[model samples]
Target chain A: MSWADTILQGVLLGGLYALFAAGLSLVFGIMRLVNLAHGDLIVLAAYLILVLVSGLGLHPFLAVLIAMPLMFGIGWLLQAYVLNRTLGPDILPPLLVTFGLSVVLQNGLLQAYSADSRRIPSGSLETASVALGPFNVGVMPMLTFASAVAVILILNRVLYGTELGRAFRATSDDAVTAGLMGIRPNRTFAVATGIAMAIVAIAAVFLGTRANFDPTIGPARLIYAFEAVIMGGLGSLWGTLAGGVVLGVAQTIGGAVNPEWQILAGHIAFVLVLLVRPRGFFPRAVD
Target chain B: MHGRTIPWRVETRTKASTVFAVLAAMIIVVGVVAPAYLPRATLQDLFFILTMLVLAQSWNLLAGYAGLVSVGQQAFVGLGAYAMFAGVVLLKLDPLVAILLGGAAAALLAIPAGFFAFRLQGAYFAIGTWVVAEIVRLLIAQWKTLGGGTGTSLPGAATRAMFGTDLVQRLMGVRPAQAVDIICYWLALLLAVATIFTVYRLLRSRHGLALASVRDNQEAARAVGIDARRLKAMVYLTSAALTGLVGALIYVQKARISPDAAFSVIDWTAYVIFIVVIGGIGTIEGPIVGVLIFFALQKLLADFGSLYLLALGLIGIVIMLFAPQGLWGLFASRTGIQLLPVRRLLRGGSLDT
Candidate 1:
C-alpha cells in the first residue's frame, strides 16, 4: 500500500511538472523559440498571485484567476515587442535575449521581493486529505492534478478544434506561407505567447501551493520543465505529461532509497531519456 | 581557373601589431610595479578582472568561433575547483600544483560532456550543457570528503605551503594574505596573457579558418573537407581546459570552495556571456575590452546589489538587439582599426609596377 501510495504521489507530483512544461511547450511548438526565462516567468506569476492574496485579500485560486489575464498581457507585449524581432536565421539572438530576460527577471524579482521564501497559505485545503482504497491523497494535490488534466484537455481542444489553433499550426509550419495565406505570423506568435502565459499563471497557483518559492528557485524548476518537454518529445502536449510522470517517479523512487538522491534521480532520468531517444519520446514530425 | 596569375606578397603584421606590442609591454611593466605602490584591495580587484578575462576568452572561443554557446560552463569551473580541493586535501600536493591537476580533470570531463552536448543542436545544446552542469553540481554536493554541500576551505597547511608565497612575501614585504594576493595576481596576469595569445594564434591558423567556415555553414564546410564535429569537440575541450584552470585559480585565491559558489551560473557563465556579448564576441580584442568595462561597472555599481545585475541584463539585451556585433564591433567598424588583426593582405607589387 505504501509503495502504491508513493507511485500515486509521484504521478500527482508529475501533474505539477506538466503544468510547468505546458507553457514552455506551447511557446516552443508554435515559434520554435525556447524561452530561457520560462521558469522565471513562472516564479513571477507565483509572486503576482502572492501579491493578490496578501494585498487584495483574495483566495489563492481566485487570485490566480485575476493574475491570468495580466500575465497574458505581459507575455503578449513581451513577444510582440521584444522576442519577435529576434526570430529568423540565427538562433543566438533569441536564446541570448531570453537568457538576458531570465537574468533580468530573476534579479528584478529579488529587488522587489527580498530573498525570503514564500508559500501560498492554503486554509483547510492544506491539511485536508481524501481517503482512497489504499492511499490518502491531499486535496490540494488532487485539485492540482485535476487542473493539470483539464488544462491539457482544453489546450488540445483549442489547438485542434479552433480557428486560432489553425493559425498557430499554419504559422508554426511555415511563417512565410502562413503570411501568404493572410495569417499574421508575428501576431500569431504574440497570441500564442499570451496563451502560454495564461497557462503559466495556472501552473503558478499549483506551484505556489505545493512548495516554498523564491526568486532563485525558477531556474531549477526550468530544468525540470525542460527535461519534461524534451523527454516527452518537442511539440507533443501529452508527451510532456508523460515526461513529467517519468521525472516524478524517478525522483520519488530515488528519495525512497535515499533522500539526497531525489533531485539527482530526476536529472539522471532526464539524461537517460536523452541518451536512449535523442529526439525524445514523441518528437514532432516537423522538427 | 585564373587566366594569368602573378605572385603576391602577403603581409600578416601591420603597424598595429607593433603598437599593440609596445602597449602590452608597458601594461606588463605597470602590472609588475603596481603592487609595490597600490593597496591590497586593488590587487585583489585586478586578480578578479584577470580571471574573468580568461573565462570570457575561453567562452568566446566556443561561442564566437565554434558556434557552441554553452550555458553550463560553471560545471567545469566547479569541477576544476573541487579537483583542486581534492588534490590539495587528499593528495597533499601544493595548491598551485593542484590547480593544474584540477584543470586536467576538467579537460577530461569535457570529453564526455562534449559527446553528450554535440548530439543536440542549437538551443537544445545550450540547455543540455546546463543540465550536465546541474548533474555535476548535485553529484558533487553528495561527496562528503569535499565538505558535502556546505563546502570546505583550503587546509592551513596547503595555504601556508602554497608555491611562490615566500618569494612574493620576500619581494613585496607584505602580510601573508597580501603576499598570497600578489602571487595570485601575477599568476592571473600570466594566464590572461596566455589565453589571449593562444586564442589569437589559433584564430590565425588554418584550423581556425576551418572552424569559421564550419560555423558559417556546417554542410558546406563538410563538403569542403572539414570535420565539423571534430573541430567543435576540440574547441569545446580547449575552452573547458582554460575555464577549469581559471576556476581552480579562482578558488585557490578565495581560499575556500563550495559547490554553489563553484557552480554558480550568474557568477561564472552569465557574467562571462554578458562580457563577451557586450565586448564584441568572436573578436580577440573584445573580451579584453569587455572585462575592463565590466570591472569598471562593478566598481561603480557594486552597492546597488540586485539592481546592478538587473541593469547588466537589460543592457545586454539592448546590446544584442541594437548592436549584435557588440561595442568592439561598433568601435572597429567606425574606426577601421584592429589592434589584433588576423587577416592576411595580398599585395601584387611587381605586377603593379
Candidate 2:
C-alpha cells in the first residue's frame, strides 16, 4: 500500500476508536470518575440499537437516534443514583462498584442474548465509499470518523463556550470548590454521564455496523477506548483522535505484515507509548 | 521483656483463632457432603465455583487490602494458563505440577509489570492493569507455541488422564473422574483457605498495620515514612501470583486452554471484582461469600436469558447505590462479624451493657 493508503486507512479506523474512546474521555474529562463500565455501555447501546432496528424496522441510523435519548436517561440515572454513592475520598469504592457493574452488564446481556452475536442492519451504504486520492474508504467509516470530529468539536465548544461545560470543568477541577460556586456536583455528574452515553450510542452505531456484536464484546471495545484515552492523555479530546489514528495505523500496518499481527501491533504501540510517556503522549496538565 | 515506652495494642487473637477453626470445619463438612447432593456435572461446576472463589479472594487482597483496584487481573490468569499449557506441551509435566510452575510464571511476569503499572494512581492504575492484560493477550496471540490468534487446545486425553481414568471411561462414568475432581475441589478449597489465612496474617502483622494505615489515609501514612508505592507493588505481585495459580486450576478442570478462555477479562477480572464488591472489599470472607451468592444467583436465573441480564444489571445498579459495602456489610452490621479471621472480635458477657 502507498503512504496515502496507510494514512487514509489509519484515519478511517481512527474514527472507530474515537467512537470507542469519546464516551470514556468525556466522562474522565468532566468528572474524575473512571467508569469502568464505559465499554459495556457501548455494548449495551449496540444491543439497544439492535432491538430498535429489529423490533421497529427502523434504519440503523434511526435506531441509533432512538437509542441515544434512552441511553442518556439510563446513564443519567446510573450516575445520579448509583455512581454518586460511590464517589468519595477513596477511589476504591467507585472502581470496585464499576467492576461489579461490568460483570452484571455483560452477564445480563449474555443471559438475555446468549453468546450469539448480532449486527445492526445497515443498508448497502455501509459499503458505499468515495475515493480520496488513491485510497478508497468505506462511507460508514468516513461518517464515523466525521462524527468523532464533530463530537469533539461540539464537546470543546460546550466545555469552553457553555455553562454546563464550565460546570463540567469546574467539577473536574474541584468538586468541593465547585460546590462553593453553587454547582450541584451530583447533578453535573448525572448530566455528564447522560451526555457521555449519548456519544456512546453514536459509537455503537458504527461498532455494530462494522462488526458482529454480543454482550461479551464490550470489554474488547473497553480495551480500545482505554488505550486511546491513555495514549492521548486524559482530558485532551483531540489527543483521543490522535491516539485513535495511531492505533488504527498500527493495526492496519500490522495486518498488512500478517493478518495475525493486527491486534498485537496495537498493543505493542500502547506499551511503547506508555514506556515513552507514562501519562500519555498528550497528557493534560490540568488533569 | 520490659519496655521503656509501651505502644498501644489491641488484642482479639483469641476470638479470631476460634472463629478460624469453626469456618474451617464448616468448609470441610460442606466439601465432603455437597458432592453427594450434586450431580457429576454439577460437582464439576462446583469445582469451578471454588476456583472463582479463590480468584476473587486473591483479587480482594490487591484491591480490598492493598487498595489497588486492578482491572487487568485476567493477565495473570491468562499467563498462568499459558504457562501450564507450556508445561504440559513442552515439558510434559503432570497437570498438578504445572499449577505451581504456573503460579511462579505469573509472579515472575507481574514483577516488571508492577513497576510500570504501580506508577499510576486510582483510575489510572486500574487502566494500567488492564493495559497489561491487553499486552499479555496480544503478545501470546503472536507466539506459535501458544497458538497465537486462533488459540490452541490442550490434548484432551492428557487432561482427562489427570483424573486417573482413561478418557472414555471417565466420560462414561465407569470410572468417575470422581477422585480427581474431588481432589481438585479439595485443592481449590485448601488454597482458598491458605490465601485467606495469608492475607489475614498480613493484616495482623506490623507490616499489615502499616498497609492498613496506607489504605485508610495515604498522606498520614506518608508523613509517618511508609513507602506506600513499594508496599502496593508487593501486594500487587502477590495477588498476581495467587490469581495466576487459580487460573491454572481453572484450566486444568476445564480440560482446555484457549486465549479467549484463559485471558478472558470478563471471566476472572470483572466477575471477581463483582464478587469482592457485592460481598465486601477489604474482607477475606466477602469474595468467598460473594462468589457463592453470585454463582447461586446465576444458577437460579439461568433460564431467564436476557431478562436475567436486565435483572443482574439492575441488581448491580442497586448494589452500587445502596449497598456499597455489599452483602457482607449488612451481615457485619447485624452481627459485628469479621469472618475469614482477618479481624478479631470480642464477644460480650452477660450484663456487660
Candidate 3:
C-alpha cells in the first residue's frame, strides 16, 4: 500500500515534468531550434505572474490569465527578431545565441528581483488533498495533472486540425519547399514559439505554486525538461508525458532507496533509456 | 641528390613563422621578467587570463574544428579538480604530480562520456554532454571525503608542501605566497603558449585538413577515407585532457575545491563559449582577441553586478546575429590576414598568376 502511494505521487509529479517539456517539444517539432533559454523563459513567465499578483493584488490564477498574452507577444518577437537570424546550415549560432539569451535572462531577473527565491502563495489550494482509495493526493498535483492533459489535448487538436498547424507541419517537413508553396516558414516558426510561450506560462503557474524559484533554478529545470523530451523522443508530445512519468517514478523509487539517489536516479534512467533506444522510445519518423 | 630540385614542392612555410618566432621570444622574455617586476595582484590577474586562454583554445579545438559544441566542459573541469584532491588526499601524491593525474582522470572519463554524447547530433549532443556533466557532479557529491556537496578545501600542509614552491621562493626571493603565485603564473603562461602552438601545429597538419573536411560535411569526409568518428573522439579526448590540466592548475592555485565551483557551467562553459563566439570560433587568434575583450569588459563592469552578464549576453547575441564570424572574422575580411597561416599555399604560380 505504501509503495502504491509513492508511485501515485510519482505519477502526479510526472505531470509537472510533462508541462515543462511540452513547449520545448513544440518548438523543436516545428523549427528544429532548441531554445537553451527555455527554462529561464518559463521562470520569466512565473515572475511576470508574481508581479501581477503582488502589484495588482490579483489572484495568482487570474494573474496567469493576464500574463499569457504578454508572454505570447514576448515569444513571438523573440523568435522573429532574434532567433530567426540564427537559423542556418551551421548549428552553433542558434545554440550560442540561445545560451547568451539564457545568461541575459537569468542576470536580468537577478537585477530586477535579486537572488531571493519566491513562491506564488496559493493559500488553501496548496494544502488541499483528496483521498483516492489507498492514497491521498494533493489537489494542486491533481489540478496540475489535469491542466497538463488539457494543454496536450488542446495542442494536439490545434496541431492536427488547424490550417496553421498544417503550415507548421509543412515547414517542419521542408522549410524551403513550404516557402515555395507560399508558407512563410519564419512566421510559422514565430507563431509556434509564441504558442509554446503561452504553454510555458501555464507551466509557470503550476511551478511557482509548487515550490520556491529563483533565477539560478532555470538550468536545473531545463535539464529535467530536456530529459523528458529525450526520453519520450523528439516531435512526439504524448511520448514526452510518458517519459516524464518514467523519470518521476525512477526518482521517487530512488529516493525510497536512498534520498541522495533521487536526482541521480532520474539521470541514470535517462541514460539507460538512451542506451536502449538511441533515438528515444518513439522517435519522429522524419528526423 | 641534395642538389636535385623537386618539380612540385608543397610550400608549407609562410612568413607567419617569422612573426611567430618573434612573438615566442617576446612571450619568453615577459614570462621570465614579469614575476620579478609585477605586483602579486597583477601576476594573479595574468594567471587568470592565461588559464582562460587555455580553456578558450581547448574549446575552440573541439567546437571549431570537430564541430562538437559541448556546454558541459565543466564536467572535465570538476572531475579534474576532484581527481586532484583525491590524488593528493587519498594517495598522498605530490600536488604537481596529482595535477597531471587529474588531466589523465578527466581524459579517462571522456571515453564513456564521448561514447554516450556522440550518439546525439546537433543540439541534442550539446544537452547530452550537459547531462553527463550533471551525472558526474551527482556522483562526486556522494563522495563523503570530498565534503559531499558542500566540498572541502586543500589541506594547508598539502598546499604548503607543493613541489617547486621552496625552489620558487629561493629563486624569486619572495614570500611563500608570492612565490607560489609566480610559479602558477609561469605554469599558466607556459600552458597557454603550449596549447596555442600545439593547436596551431595541429591545424597545419594533414589531420587538420581531415577535421576541416569533416566539419564541412561528415559524409564527404567519410567518403574520402577519413575515419571521422575516430578523429572526433581523439580531438574530444585531447581537449578534455588539456581542459582537465587547466582545471587542476586552477584549483591548485586557489587551494580549494568545491563541486559547485568546479562544475560551474556559467563560469567555465558559458564564459568560454562567449569568448569563442565573440572572438571567432574557428580561428587561432580569435581566443586571444576574445580573451582580451572579455577581460576588459569583466574588469570594467564586474562592479555593476548582473548588468555585466546582461551586457555579455546582449553583446554575444548582437555579434551572433550581425557578425557570426566574430571580431577576428570581421578583422580578417577587411584585411586578409592569417596569423597562424594554417591554410595551404600553392608553391608554384597558378596559370593566371
Candidate 4:
C-alpha cells in the first residue's frame, strides 16, 4: 500500500491501542495504581464477550453491552476488597499484588480456555470497508476509531464534568484531605475502577473483533497500553490517544520494512520518546 | 567517681547471629560435599535452588533494600545468558569465563537501563524496567546468529570440553554429562554463598544504612547528604551483575538457550519477586527461607501445569495482603531474633542496665 494508506492504517490501529490504554490511564491517573493485570482484564472482557456471542448467540455489540456492567461489578469488588488493601506508603505491596494478580488472571484464563486463540466472529462487518479519500479502510477499523474517540470523550466528561469527577480529582490530589472532606476516597476509588473496567469492556469489543487473542497475549497489550500512557504523558487523556497513534504508526511503518521489526519498532519509538520527553508529550501540571 | 568512663559498645552481631553463623558454615560444608553423596537428580535440584537463591537475593537487595522495585530483571538474566552463548559459540571462550562476561554485559546493559528507568519513579520505574527488558528480549531475538527467535544450544563438544568438566568427571567418577551438572552445581553453590555473604556484609556496612534510609524516605536520606540516586544506581548495577551471573550459570546448567525461556518475566522476575516477598523482603534470611518453601511448593505442584503458577500468584497476593513482611519477617518479629543481624544495638550501656 501507499505511505498515506499505511499511516492511515496505523492511526486506525492506534484506536485499538488507545482503547487498551484508556482504562489503565484512568486507574493510574486517579489513584496512581498501575494495574498490571489491565491487559488480562481486557482479555477477560473479550472472553466474556466471546461467550456471550458464541454461547448465548448474542450479537457482538450486544455482548459487549451486557459485559460492561458485569465487568464494572468485578472491578468494583476487586478494588474494594483486594486492591485498596495494597495502597500505602510502601510501593511494593500494590505492585506485587497487581503483578500477582496478572499471573493469576493469565493462568486462570489459560486453564479455562486452553491455549487456543479465539476471535469474536463479527461476520460481514469484519470484511466490510469504506473508502476515505484515496484509501480503503475496514468498516470495523472506522468503528473502532470512532468508539475510541467516544470512550475518551465520555471519560473526559466523567472526569471533568461530573460531581464524581470532582471527588476523583480531590481524592487523587490528597486522599487524606479528601477523606476529611467526607468524599469517601475508598468508594470513589471503587467507582473509578469500575468505570475503567467498563471501558475495558468497550475496548474488548474492538480487541476481540479486530484480531486473534489468547491467554498469554495480555502482557504485550499491557506494554502497548503502558507505552501509550507514558508517551501521552501521565493524566492527560487526549495525549494517550496521540501516543497510541504514534506507536501504531511506528509499528506499521516497521512492519512495512520488516514484519519482525513491527513490535520492536513501537517499543523503540517509546524509548526514544522517553529519552526526548521523559514526562511525555502532555504531562499534567502537578505530576 | 574520679574519671568514670562510659561502658558501652555498638554491636551488630548478636547471640543468635553467632549461632546462625555456625549453622551457616555447617550448611556450606554440607553443600560443598553434597555432589559426592547425592544423586544427579538431587544435585540438579540443588543447582536450581542455589541459582534461584542468588536471583532472589539480588532482587531483594534492589527492591527490598534500595527500593528500586523493578519488574524487568529478566533483561539482565536474558542478556547474561545470550552474552555467554556468544562467548562460547563465536568467541570460543570457556563457559566459566563466559559467565563472567555475562555478568559484565548485564552490568553494562544496566547503565543505560538505569538512565532511562531512573527518570520514572516508583510504579512507573517498575514498568520502565519491564519495557527495557522487553526491548532487550525483542532485540536479542533479532540476532540471527544466535538462532534468532528460535534460540540456540551449546555445542555438545564445547560443553564436554568445558574447562572443569574433565576434572569433575575424574574426581566424581561420573559420565561427562553428570560431570557438567556437578561443575555447574558447584558454581551455583559458590555464587549463592558469595551472593549471600556479600549482601550480608554490605548490609552491615555504612552503605546499608544509606540504603535503608533511602528506602524509608528518600527526601530525608537526601537531606542527610546521602546521594540517593547514586546509592540506588550502585545497588541496581550490583544486582544486575549478580543476577546476570546466576542467569549464565543457569543456562549453562540447562545446556540450551531460548529467548522466551531466558527472558521470561514469570521465570526470572515474578518468581524471584514472590520468593523475596514470601521470605521477608528486606532481611537476609528471607530469600533463604523463601527459596526453600518455593522449592517445596514446586515439587508438590509440579504436575498441575497452570495451576502451579495460579497457586503461586494466589499465595503471593495473600502474603502481600496479610503478611507483607513475609514469613521470615513474621517469625523475626514474634521471636525478636535476627539470625543475620544488621541492626546495630547499643549494648552494655549504663542506660541499658
Candidate 5:
C-alpha cells in the first residue's frame, strides 16, 4: 500500500484506541483513580455484547445499545460499593484494589469463556469498503472513526454544557468543598464511572467486531489506551484523540517497516513523548 | 547537678525487638541447616518463599516507604535475568558473578527509568513505570541471542560448574541437581535476610525519616530541606538493584529464561504488590507475615487453577477496603508490639524530677 494509505489506516485504527482511552481518561480526570481494570472492563463489555449477539440473535449494533445501560449499572454499583471505599490520602489502596480487580476480572473471564478468541460476527459490513481518492477504506473502520468522533463530541457536551458537568468539575477540583456545597462527590463519582462504562460498551462493540479477543488481550489494549491518554494530556478529550492518531500512525509505519516493530514503535513513541513533554501535550491548568 | 543522671533517653530497640532478634537468629540458623533434613521439593518451596520475600521487601521499600507506587517492577526483574543470562551464556562468567551483574544492570536501567517516571505523580507514576516495563519486555524479546521471544536455557556445563555447587554436593551427599537447589536456596536465604536487615536499618536511619516524610507529603518534605526527589531516586535505585538480584537468582534456580516469563507483570509486580499490600505496607514484618499467608493460600488453592487467582484478587480487594494498613498493621496496632520497631521512643523521663 502507499504511504498515504498506510497513514490513513493508522488514523482509523487510532479511533479504536481513542475509544478504549475515553473511559479511562474520564475516570482519571474525575477521581484521580487509575482503574487498572479499565481494559478488563472493556473486554467484559465485549463479552456482554458477544452473548447478546449470539444468544439473543440480536444485531451487533443492537447488542451494544442494550449492553450500554447494563454496563452503566455495573459501573455504578462497582464505584458505589467497591471503588469509593478505596479513595483516600493513601494511593496504595485504590491502586492495589483496582489491580486486584483486574486480576479477578481476567481470571473470571477465563473461567467463563475458556481461552478461545471470540469476535463479533458483523457480516457484510466487515467486508464492505468505501473509496476515498485512490484509497479504499473498510466501511467498518469508517464507522468506527465516526463513532469515536461522536462519542467524544457527546462526552464534551455532557462535560461542558450540562449542570452535571459543573458538578463533575466542582467535585474534581475540590471534593471536600464540593461535599460542603451539597454536590455529593461520591454520587457524582458514581455517575461519572457509569458514563465511562457506557462508553466502554461502545468501544467494546468496535473492539469485538474488529479482531479476535481473548481473556488476556485486555492489558495490551489498556497500554495502548494509556499511551493515548498520556500523549494527549489529562482532562482533554480532544488531545486523547490526537494522541491515539499519533500512536496509530507510529504503529502502522512501524508495521510497514517490520511487523514485529509495530507495537514497539507505538511504545517508543509514547516514551519519546514522555521524554519531551512529561505532562503530555495538553495538560490541564490545575493538575 | 553534675552528678545527676540523664532524665530521659531515646531508644529504637524495644524489649520486643531485643527478644525478636534472638528469635530471628534462631530462625536463620534453622533456615541455613534446613537442606540436610528437608527434601528437594521442600527446599524448592523454601527457595520460592525466600526470593518472594526479597521481592516483597524491595517493593515495600519503594511503594510503602518512598511513595513511588510503581507497577512495572517486572522490568527490573526481567533486565536482571537477561543480564545474568548474557553474562553466563555469552560472557562465560560464573552464574554467581552474573547475579551481581544482573543487579548492576537493573540499577543502571533505573537511572533512565526513574528520570522519566519521576515526571509523573501518584497514579500516573504507577502507569509510567508499567509502560517502561512493557518497553523493556518488548526490547528484550528482540535480543535474538538470548532466544528472543521463545527464550533460552543455561548450558549444562554452566549449571554443573557453578561456584560452590560441588562443595554443596560433597558436603550434603546429594546429586548435582539437588546440590544446585541447595546452593540457590542458601543464596535466596542470604539475600532475603540481607534485604530485611538492610530495610530495617534504612528505616531506622535519618533517611528513613526523610522517606516517611516524603510518603506523607512530598511538598512538606521538600519544604523541610529534605531533597525528596533525590531521596526517592535513591530508594528507587536501591529497590531496583535488590529486585534485580532476586530476579537473577530466581532465573538461575529455574535454569531457564524467557521474555514472557521474566517480564510477566502478574508474577513479578502484581503478586509482589499484593504481598506488600496485604501484609502491611511500610512495615518490616508485614512481608514476612504476608509471604507466609500467600504461600499457605497457594498450597490450599492449588487445585482451583484460575479460581486461585480470582480468590487472591478478591482477598486483596477486601484487605484494601477494610484494612488498608494490612493484617500485620492490624496486629501491630491491637497488640502494640513491634518485633522490628524502627520508631524512636523517648523513655525514662519525668517532668516532676
Candidate 6:
C-alpha cells in the first residue's frame, strides 16, 4: 500500500514537472528558442495569480483564466519586440539575453513581493483527497496531474491538427521558407511564444498551490523543467511528461529510502539517461 | 547576397596594448595605497571580484567563441573545490599545492565530459553539460570522505601551521595577511591577463577561423572541410580547464571548500552570462567591462536578496528584446575599441595593425 501511495504520488509529481516543461518544450519546438526565463516566468505567473486572488477575491482557477491571456499578450509582445530580434545565425544572443532577463525578473519579483514564501491558500482542497483502491491521493496533485495531461493533449492536437500548427511546423522547419510562404515568421514566433507562456500560467497555478513558493525557487524549477524536457527528448511534449515521471519516480523512491537522496536521485536519473540516450528518449526536433 | 560584404580585421594589438597599459596602471596604484586607504576585508572582497571576472572570461571563451552555450560549467568549479578539499582532508597535502591540483583535476575531468557533451549542438549541448554537472554533484555528495550532503570543513589553523614548522610559522606571522592577499590579488590579475591573451591569440589563429566558421554555419563549415564538432569539443575542454583554475584560486584564498558554494549553478553561470551578454558575446573587451559593471550592480543591490536574481532575469529579457548585441557591442560600434580582437580579413597574412 505504501508502494502504491508512493507510485501514485510520483505520477502526480510528474504532472507538475510536465507542466513546467511543457512551455519550455513548446518554445523549443516552434522556434528553437529556449527561454532561460521559463521558470521565472512560471514564478511570475504564480505571483500574477496571487495578486488576482488576494486583490480581486477570485478563486485560483479564475485567476489562472485571467493570468493566461495576460501572460500570452506579454509573451507575444516580448517575442515580437525583444526575442525576435535576438534570433539569428548566433544562438548566443538569445542565451545571453535570456540570462540578463533572468537577473532582471528575479530582482523585479523580489522588489515587489520581498523574499517571503507565499501560498495561494487552496483551503479545503489543501487537505482534500480521494481513496482509490486502498490508496489515498491529494486533490491538488490529482488536479495538477490532470491538468498536465490535458495540456499535453491540447498541445499535441494544436501541433498536429490545426492550420496554426502547420504554420508553427513550417516556421520551425525554416523561417526563411515560412516567410516566403507569407506566413509572417515573426508573427508565428510571437504567437508560439505567447501560447508557451499561457501554458506557463497553468503550470504556475499548480506550482503556487502545490507548495510554498518564493521568487528564488524559479531556478530550481528551471532545473527540474530542463531535466524533464531533456529526459523526454527536446521538442516532444509526451516525452516531457514521461521524463517528468522518470524524475518523479526516482526522486520519490530515493526519498522513500533516504530523504536527502530525493534531489540527488532526480539529477542522477537525468545523467544516467543522458549517458544511455544522449538525444533523449524521444527527440522530436533537432537544432 | 543582400549587399556587398565589408571585410573584418584580424589583429587588435593596438587596442589590447592600451587596455593592458590601463590595467597595469590600476594595479600599480591599487597595490601601493589599497592597504592604507581601504580596510583589510575590502581587499579580500576585491579578490573575490577578480575571481568572478576570471570565470566570466573563461565562459566567454567557451560559449562566446566555441558556440557551446553550456549552462552547467559549475561542475568544474565544484570539482576544483573538491580536489583542493581532498588534498587537505585525505592526502594531507599543502592547501596551496592542492589548489593547483584542484584546477588540474577539474581540467582532467572535463576532458571526458566535454567529449560526450560536444556530440550535441545548440540547446542540446547546453543540456548535456548541465547533465554532466548534475551527475558530478550527486556522485561527489555520495563520497563520504568529502562531507556528505551536510558538507565538511577545511582543516583549521593546525592545518595552516602544518604548512611549515615554527620558523615558517613565525615567517607567516610577519607576512602581513594584507600582503599575502595582495599577492593573491596579483595572482588573479596575472591569471586574467594570461586567459585574455590566450583567448585573443587563439581567436587570431587558424583554428579560430575554423571555430568562427562552425559557429556561423555548421553545415557550411562542414562542407568546407572544417570539423565543427571536434573544434567545439576542444573549446569546451579548454573552458573547463580555465573554470577549474579559477576554482582553485577561490579555494586558496577562501581556505575552505564545499559543494554548495562551489557547485552552485547560480553563482557560476549567472555572473558569467551577465558579463558575456552585457559586454557582447563575440567582443573581446565586453566581458571585462561587463564584469566591472556586473560587480557594481551586485554590490549596489546586495541587500535586495532574491530580487537581484529577478532583476537579472528582467535584464536578460530586456537585453534580449532591445539590445541583443549587448553593451560592449554598442560601445564597439560607437567607439571601435577592440580590446580582445578577433580574426579579420588578413591582408597578405599580415593582419597586425
Q: Compared with the true structure, what per-residue lDDT tens digits does model 4 show for residues B269-317?
A: 9999999999999999999999999999999997999999999999999
Specify the highest-DockQ model's number: 4
Docking class of 3: high
| Pairs of residues at least 3 apart in sequence or in different chains that clash in candidate 2 | A108-B309, A111-B305, A111-B306, A112-B305, A112-B306, B141-B148
Docking class of 5: high
Q: Which ten residues in a row have the lowest lDDT in candidate 2 chain A?
A: A92-101
What is each model's TM-score for chain A? 0.98, 0.96, 0.98, 0.99, 0.98, 0.98
Residue pairs with backbone atoms closer than 3 Å in model 4 (clashes): none
Question: What fraction of native interface contacts does model 3 preserve?
Answer: 0.83
Model 5 accuracy (lDDT, Cα): 0.92
Model 3 Cα shift for residue A183 (angstroms): 0.7
Q: Give the alpha carbon lDDT tens digit for every residue of B143-229 in model 6.
A: 788777657777665244433334433543434344446556666766776787788888888888898888777799999999877
- Candidate 1 structure quality by residue, lDDT tens digits, A1-287: 47778888888889899999999999999998989999999999999999999998899989998999999999999999999999987888898999999999999999999999999886888889989886899988888878888999999999999999999998988999999999999999999999999999999998998789999888888889999999999889999999999999889888888899999999999888888998889888456
Q: Could you report the DockQ of all the candidates, in the order they appear?
A: 0.80, 0.47, 0.84, 0.89, 0.88, 0.50
By DockQ, the candidates rank as: 4, 5, 3, 1, 6, 2
> How many angstroms is residue A184 displaced in model 5 relative to the true structure, after the best TM-score fit?
1.1
Residue range A187-263, candidate 2, lDDT tens digits: 99999999999999999999999889888777778878888888898889999998998899888888888787787
Each candidate's fnat = 0.75, 0.59, 0.83, 0.91, 0.92, 0.73
| lDDT score of residue A76 within candidate 4 | 100
Model 2, range B119-204, lDDT digits (tens) per residue? 67678789888878888887887778767767777776566566444553544444545655665676787777778778878888
Runs with alpha carbons beyond 4 Å of true place in candidate 6: B1-42, B138-147, B158-176, B298-328, B334-345, B348-353
Model 1 residue B338 CA deviation in Å: 1.1
Per-residue lDDT of model 5, residues B1-353, tens digit only: 44555578878987889999999999999999999999999999999999999999999999888888999999999999999999999999999999999999999999999999998888888988988999999899999999999999999789779999889888878999888889999999999999999999899899998888877778898898999889989999999999999999999998898999999998999889888888998899999999999999999997998999999999999998889889999999999999999888876654424
Cα lDDT, model 2, residue B256: 65
* After superposition, candidate 3 runs with Cα above 4 Å error: B1-9, B350-353
Output the better candidate (3/6) by TM-score: 3
